[model samples]
Target chain A: MKIIRSVAEMQKETLMHKENKRSIGFAPTMGYFHKGHLQLIEEAKKENDIVAVSIFVNPLQFGENEDFGRYPRDEKRDIQLAESYGVDLLFIPTVEEMYPTKPQLNMVMVDRVDVLCGKSRPGHFDGVVTVLAKLFHIVQPNRAYFGLKDAQQIAVVDVLIQQYNFPIELIRVPTAREDNGLAMSSRNVYLTEQERAEAPAIIHALQEAKSLMENEERHPAVIVEKVRALLQQHTSAKIDYVELLSYPELKTIEQINQQVIVAVAVQFEKARLIDNIIYHP
Target chain B: MKIIRSVAEMQKETLMHKENKRSIGFAPTMGYFHKGHLQLIEEAKKENDIVAVSIFVNPLQFGENEDFGRYPRDEKRDIQLAESYGVDLLFIPTVEEMYPTKPQLNMVMVDRVDVLCGKSRPGHFDGVVTVLAKLFHIVQPNRAYFGLKDAQQIAVVDVLIQQYNFPIELIRVPTAREDNGLAMSSRNVYLTEQERAEAPAIIHALQEAKSLMENEERHPAVIVEKVRALLQQHTSAKIDYVELLSYPELKTIEQINQQVIVAVAVQFEKARLIDNIIYHP
Candidate 1:
């Protein structure tokens, strides 16, 4: 794999591929590669003539004291694995390179950022959309892969593409999970020994909620409350939020008749775990 | 020439050309085509295999009490002229078609908007960037054209292109003018007959300032003051502003040594006029 450290060269490379009529697929990450990252790369490789991956731990996306500095990195392994996965291009820009200039005066705050993980982390989706906007220009991808691991992020990306009319397709890759059903994430390394033992409970809670949803229990509040109780019972963590809202649109619904996302976040000692199940009720 | 009123079809049309390795040049306007609009279209046609023009009287770019409601249109003549000029595709989306959904919550406020015409019209450039962002996505042109008549707008477009990493060249077409040197603008239709006769004084004032700079005038304040006095002496319109700033950056300069823009705006009874000349001093 060819590793690029400059934005201009990356844009030039992508433009060359574009001129050659190659469909490029892009997967953007924050470096510490895991099974989820591999899955996204695989998805890209399956569909496009060229696959590009970006590892940018954008400071704009991290809220105050939200581990922007302490975000873990496994660069050597990541580079090797990228080659093994057949990534055509890898972009690893320094923080200074990514943000050479000071940020814009007024921020791009999203409209549907009032719920889910977005509720506690204000401006987080805005930051995500902003960086993606920049990266999309550089990569010039025909399709970009984003995991359903952070469903809110996927929804925000949808809005970004629609509102900006970015002529790029957003592919939603399914969450890569462990044997125990825990969602795969680089931040899993932040879990302490005991916290790691209890981490799988997040997915387990969501699975139970999904079962309830599948069984035709239609009260959103009741399902959310049950999920919260299950999380509290299965793990020693503070419940951040348990929400059931309309999928993609992400609005509160009085009755669960359409598609909905039942999501939950739990704050462990070191890591905050989030998981969700989207289904038609 | 094909005229696309639907955003989806326009996007597909552009994408087809993009995939076929045909370069597209784009000119975005608000209909009522004139010499300036023709100049931009001509520039686009000169360089690309495909040329696309959009006529959207973007409501977002108009401030409250602005002329959005009365923005002139000559749809039949505009369409005929577009075809006569050999435009490959012309997109004239209605307000409802262009804006199917409500706008995003938070606005994109630009920096360097506190001077010149931007000072009087707040959020004007923000609206321009917003609409342009959407249009750029749909058109997906290799190069986009804009007139240097609104120098501040060009500066804002430069920032938008840079900040968002839009992979499109901005072609700054020169301002097409009337025989007496009044800048060609659709808003000129609103000018009374006498006002039209006096409008050339704005350019005369700027020309006098340019002469001062060419003769080694270093102080922007002095040149600006002289231009304001000339405009006041020659035109019946109220002088909105006469200022000199760094080129493209649009910042106040200590002394005019590098590239700079000497810009002015005048408020007639029914129309506001803007003009500028950018050159190395």
Candidate 2:
């Protein structure tokens, strides 16, 4: 596997691949490889002539008070994991390489960011779209892989691709989960022993909400209250939010007749965990 | 020459060019072919294996009171002129084709805007960069051409390319002008015969400012005052603005020790005309 560190070099490599008519599949990620990230790479490896993975912890996506400085990174392990998955190229750009100077233009989200995690974390989606735009231009991937664990992010990417007309196919892999039904995440490392024990309740609450929706609980307000009560009764974690909205569009839905997302965020002693399930009624 | 009217078709055509290893040079313009637009096409024809021209009168760049509805367009003449220049592909997408839905994200200018024409036209640069971003992604030109007639635009494009790390190179063509020294523009058609005759004074003021700077006048205020006085005396036009600043950066400079831009705008009875000259000291 070839390890690339510079944006210019990666672009040149991708251009050569294009000239040779090779299909490139890309997986962009922050470091500290987890099962969820590996699932995305596996999907890419199966579909393309070359699979390229970028492991850059984008600083632009982190707010001033967010965990940017303490974001977990294990370069050696990540490189090994990616290589083991038969990734053809591994790009690990430094913060300086990704952003030599502050951008003079901002890519601001105009929609699909008013509920769920977006409401609690302002400017987070903007930071995400900006870095992703840069990555998409640099990689020029024929198709890019993103896990559905970040459902809102996938929705935002859909809008970006459609609006800008980027010649890329977005491939979404289903969320990878632990044996206990907790969604796999790199942030899982931040959890203490006690917090880790309580994290699975976030997913449990989502599953219960889905079951309730399946059992003819159509009102979003009722579903949200039941999910909140389940989290309160079962786990020591403080409820951040429990929201039900239209999938992808994230618009308010009065009744569950179509696809909707039931998402929850909970604050443990040392970690904030999030989980969601897309329901069709 | 092949004419593309759909964004999907244009993107596919560009993708085929990329796979074939052909270098594409792009010229983006509003319709109504002028000497300036032709000059840009001519330069593209010389350097690239394939020259592509897009004639889009982008509404995003026009203000509420501006002439967006009345923007000049002559498709038959434009197609003929582009074909004569050996343009391999001509992309003419409708506003609906370009923006099927209103953009859910906005690319906003953070700098290089607050001066010159940007001072009077708020959100104009935002609209410009937004459309350009979409065009660049769809066309995927190896190198894109822009005339330096709009100097601040070139500056904004410079930032956009650098910040996004677009793989395309930017080639700037010098401004094309009429014999009497008025910069050739599609809007030149809006001027009455008498107004057209006096419009050359905009360029004349720029030249006078250049000469003054060359003759050791370093203070921006003194040079601007002299240029304003010259325009007032030489033509029956309303002075919109006369300003001097650092080239590309568009920042105020105390002394003329480096490259600078002297730009002016004048409003006639029916048309608004602008011109500028870059000076090195």
Candidate 3:
């Protein structure tokens, strides 16, 4: 696999692929590869002639108080993991390389960002969209793969693609999870042994909410309260929020008649974990 | 020349061009074509295998009380003029087509928009960047052309291109002018005959400032004051602003020892006109 560090070199490689009429499938990620990122790369490899993976722990996406400085990065392991998944190109750009100049304009999120993690992490999606915009332009991929672990991110990308008319197709892979049903995340590494043990409770709460919805319980408020109670009772996790929102649009729904996402965020002793289940009712 | 009205069709056409390894040059404009737009098209045609021009009078760029409703549009004339300039594709998408959903997120301009026309017309550059982002994605131009008349716009576009890492090269075409030196603008149609006659004074003021700089005038404030005095005395135009700024960066430079732009804006009885002269010292 070819590894590129500069934007110009990466763009040139993509342009050559375009000229050669080869389809490129891109999976953009922050390093410290987990099962989730590998799955995305594997899916991209299956669909395109070239599967390119970018490992950029975007600083713009992190809040001032967030764990940007301590965000897990393992470039050697990440490169090996990506290569194992048959990634054709590995783009490992430094922060300085990615942002040569301080960004003057922002790709501000106007909608689909008021609920869920967005409420707690303001300007996070904006940073995601901004970096993705830059990467999409550089990669010029035929299709870009994003994991459904970040369903709100997928929704934001949908708006960006529609709003800006970016030519690339967005392919959403299902969320990768641990055997215990906890969604795999880079932040999972931050969890202590005790926090890791409690992390699955977040997913358990989401599953319980899904089961309630499956049992024809229609009231959103009731479902949310039950999930919140379950998290509060079973785990030492402090509930950040347990929200029932319209899928993708993230608008409030009085009754769960259509597709909905039951998302929960909980603060453990050492880490915050998030999990959600999308349901059709 | 192929005329496309739908975003899907335009994107497909551009994709075909990419697959065929053809370079595309794009000129994005608001309809009523003037010499300036034609000059942009002409420059675009010279640079690439395909020259595409998009006519979109973006509503996002206009203020609530601005002339969005009365913005000049002449599709038939524009089409003919573009065809005459050897434009390969003419993309004329309706406002509804361009913005299928009301944009909830905005490409907010943080820098390069606080002075001159940007101060008077807030959110104007944001709108321009938003629509251009859409157009640039849809058209996928190798090189995009813009007139130097709106120097601030070029500065903003520069930031957008640099920040977003768009693959397209930005070509700044020299400002097209009338016989008497008035920078050609579609808004000139709004000017009365007398207003039209006096519009040349805006350019004259810029030239006067340039000459003063050329004659070893070092103070930005002094050059600005002289230009403002000239516009106030010689023309009936109401002086909007006559300021000097560092080129491209548009920052305030106390001393004229480097590349600078002397820009001016004036309000006539029925229209507002803007012009600038870039000087290297």
Give the candidate number with the greatest lDDT: 3
What's the TM-score of each model vs. the native?
Answer: 0.96, 0.98, 0.98
- Whole-model lDDT values for every prediction: 0.89, 0.89, 0.89
Candidate 2 lDDT over residue span B165-228, tens digit each? 8888999899999999999988898898888878888888888898898899999999999899
Residue pairs in clash, model 2: none
Per-residue accuracy of model 1 over B1-281 as CA lDDT, tens digit each: 99999999999999889889899999999899999999999899899999999989999989998989988989999999999999999999988887778865344755768898789888888888888888998999899999999888888887778877788999999999999999999999989999998999999988999999999999998999999898988889998888899987788998999999999989999999999888796
Pairs that collide, model 1: none
True contacts kept of each: 0.68, 0.90, 0.90
Choose 2 or 3, whichever is better by DockQ.
2
lDDT of model 2 at residue A243?
88
Best by DockQ: 2
Q: Cα deviation of B248 in candidate 3 (Å)?
A: 0.7
Provide per-model DockQ scores. Answer: 0.62, 0.87, 0.86
For model 3, how does the per-residue alpha-carbon lDDT over B170-207 read when each residue is reduced to its tens digit? 99999999999989898998999888877787888888
Model 3 CA lDDT for position B59: 90
Query: Where does candidate 2 chain B have its weakest 10-residue lDDT segment?
Result: B266-275
User: Candidate 3 DockQ score?
Assistant: 0.86
